[model samples]
Target chain A: MTTTAVDILGADDVSRAITRISHEIVERNPALDSVVIVGMQTGGTWIAKRLCESVNKIVEGANVPLGAIDISLYRDDYSLRPVVLSAPTDIPVDLTGRTVVLVDDVLFTGRTVRAALEALNDYGRPRAVQLAVMVDRGHRELPIRPDYVGKNIPTHFSDEVAVGPNGVTVSAVAT
Target chain B: MKHLLDTHDLSIDDIVNILDVADRMAEVNRRQVPKVPALKGKTIATVFFEDSTRTRLSFETAARRLSADVLTFLASSSSVNKGESLRDTIETLSAMGVQAFVVRHKSSGVPLQLSQWTDASVINAGDGWHQHPTQGLLDAYTITREFGTPTSLAGRTVAIVGDIKHSRVARSNIDLFTRLGARVVLVAPPSLLPSHVETWPVDVRSTMDDVIDNVDVVYLLRMQLERMQSASIPNLAEYTRLYALTPERAAVLQDHALLMHPGPMNRGVEITVDPADVAGSRILQQVTNGVSIRMAVLFTLLGGDSVSSLTAGGEA
Candidate 1:
């Protein structure tokens, strides 16, 4: 099956989705002071920054700490997938009792999120974890769900979605 | 990345790749919380057929911090004490399915032999007067970290001084440093120099002071007084006066130059305490970087990641 690449969303949609995600986050945890935002490296990093900025602008006293995690080490499929290189996992704030809003670009097999959760456990116990994603490509092999999602772009099992600062694109071998 | 038996197996690209991945591994050591889940389900066997204070402990710590289950075998108390051959011990452990074996043997080529005996990766911790690949790797990683560039050593000079005949660290470093594009030199007494010094990819000098002022890094190898027993070196004072890094020699180092040592030093003999304790000394840093380098080695070999992937993340 030859697959193809196509632009799915533009910058405006991403920006709007993040703003909505920011609102949902603030409403879920009323004060927003105890919520910590963490981005998955290389992709979730930028979106998490934008989300944190939006979250700060919505509430007074503004400061919500941020950190980044490299879930490559926590991955379960080292025997199956091309491994991602290790990056500095800088968790700036203590996660104990703080609400961690885990951020990522695309929510697919739920494996990445699963790895992220396992990685975070090494840091410390969080009050709770709520996943936020810019795109939900909906073929989750694991029974996992994102609490705040920007757009739901259902895709073929073979296609891959890549979310960047400017926009999002889905690609697969051209069939 | 698979079975780091020696630095000779590494190309410039392979050497640089190990350093780049080591950059990420080094972060785990420096993190506020010193642990990672990189090798969570993996089992690592540290088989030391020789006495070791640092390499054995460092490998065990590195494995543990990465969350890997560790099984240690010391030759003195193990079945090897009961007359079992090295092959028997290894095959016994391989039977239990360790993903990797960090082997340090008194004889050269044991790591290579063990690698042949099992599918598990074999890391040469220290094998006779052969290769100590991880030591070479951590040293490169330390230098790369200090300079903030992996390729910056291309034109630099690194002098490995003392005990060239008996030091495996010297052998591995020469292979690694030269591959990373550094000019290497060996400085030791005539009796202490290796038999094949002319064949190695480095210059040889009768004394360190001859080229001491020109090098970017002055790497000192521990003077194996134990091995010098049958050699012609008469006394410790003679060895010190000729090769020991004294306070005066330390002052002559080029600006920004570093001093590195693979530890368990004969302090007053090969190097004085003052020179070793200098501001830019990379001795302690080498020890700390050991864990991360080994972590990268174990991960790349067993993670099903192609060895080429070691060069993937860091742009430099």
Candidate 2:
């Protein structure tokens, strides 16, 4: 199946979105002294790092901890293929007392986000975790929902979203 | 993703997908920017209950290339030696924010148990003689790269020589080769070969010479002296005489046939062939392909792109 690329957010637009999301997070969670951003590998990770940078720029002296998470091994498909172990997670800052902003590129079936949540639990329990995504395209099979959404795009189940250096586009097929 | 507990966890499609990704990862090495920011800011913890230099180093290198942070926990230095439980150690690492865990244990199925205990992704580095899935993958990648796309090993005979009953590498390779259609022949002394070899899919031959000339590939397995209680055979000398891949015996193979070994070689005992022959043996290729194959796995699992995008990227 082939997916048609539908433009939802561009590089410039993503930057703006992050800036706005940062402000929203700080405003909503007033009690937190600092925030740590954890990306859910690949696109989520990139977005999380960018969001951390943006938040830092807005709030001076803000301790924006950044981390990347790889959930490959926790995947349900482990038995079905060759097992490749990637690098471990590195969260320089402690999650014990900090508000965690979990960042991802796209929110579709919510399986990845669910996996990310499970992965995060292993690290330690954070004071709170808020989900943020560049695109919330619906079709969630789980009860999970993103707290901060950059853009909401209606899509068919057959369609898939692609986020790259260029921009965000929806393809009818996953490609 | 549940941790890959054993080869039984993988289907044919999973194997093919990993190989395909490994093929792409091989190309990454040739790029100006070998580092992919894909895993930037992620953490991967390597919890090795066994002493492994190659496997540990390879996993560390793979994670760094993808820009992920890594923590290496050696069993010797850790509480594991002080009677610290595996579950306790893993749970502690999990609490430390380790997203992925690369584990190696002396006991088989330790990774399986760890998978159930924590939320972190678990990759089995080695678990007793149960399985070494990544080793099998890299071997397959090496063979495919050397001999062209492994269409089917139907006519191809693979002679696996060495400690058959003790080497997890042998067990994993046997499974992978057989699934890809290769007829596997286990070459070992009666002492080394398990008594129930007949139950396995491959043929078991006590005489190395019987299958030496007929096989298309001779995969030499390392003799894990550490694992053996008393010598399974009389001694290393007798074992070498009967099972070692000596230079003289290697000459009997067809000119087109290849030799393979998963390293940490036993020198004169398991292989009478010179270590330099490993250049021609495709052992080093297996090592190099290891990084590429692992990268493929890391990216495929963490890329976050849809299946269609991955296909498009593959085509591109």
lDDT of 2 by residue, A59-123 (tens): 77776678877655345433333444454455666577677889888888777677677666655
- Candidate 1 per-residue lDDT over residues B108-156, each given as its tens digit: 9999998999888899999999989899888888887788777647888
Instruction: Tell me the spans in candidate 2 whose CA falls farther than 4 Å from its real position.
Output: A1-175, B226-229, B275-279, B305-316
Docking class of 2: incorrect
Residue B124 lDDT (model 1):
91
Each prediction's DockQ against the real complex:
0.35, 0.02
In model 1, state the lDDT of residue A110: 86
List TM-scores for all candidates, in order. 0.92, 0.63
- Give lDDT tens digits, candidate 2, residues B1-316: 3456676678888887778767656644644445545566678898998889999998888888777899999988988778988889999999999878888998998988998999877888889878888888888777766767744455677889888888888888888889887888998887777768899998888877788777778898888776456667777887788888888788787776778888888888788888565334777777888888777666555544233332212000
A141 Cα displacement, candidate 1 (Å): 3.0
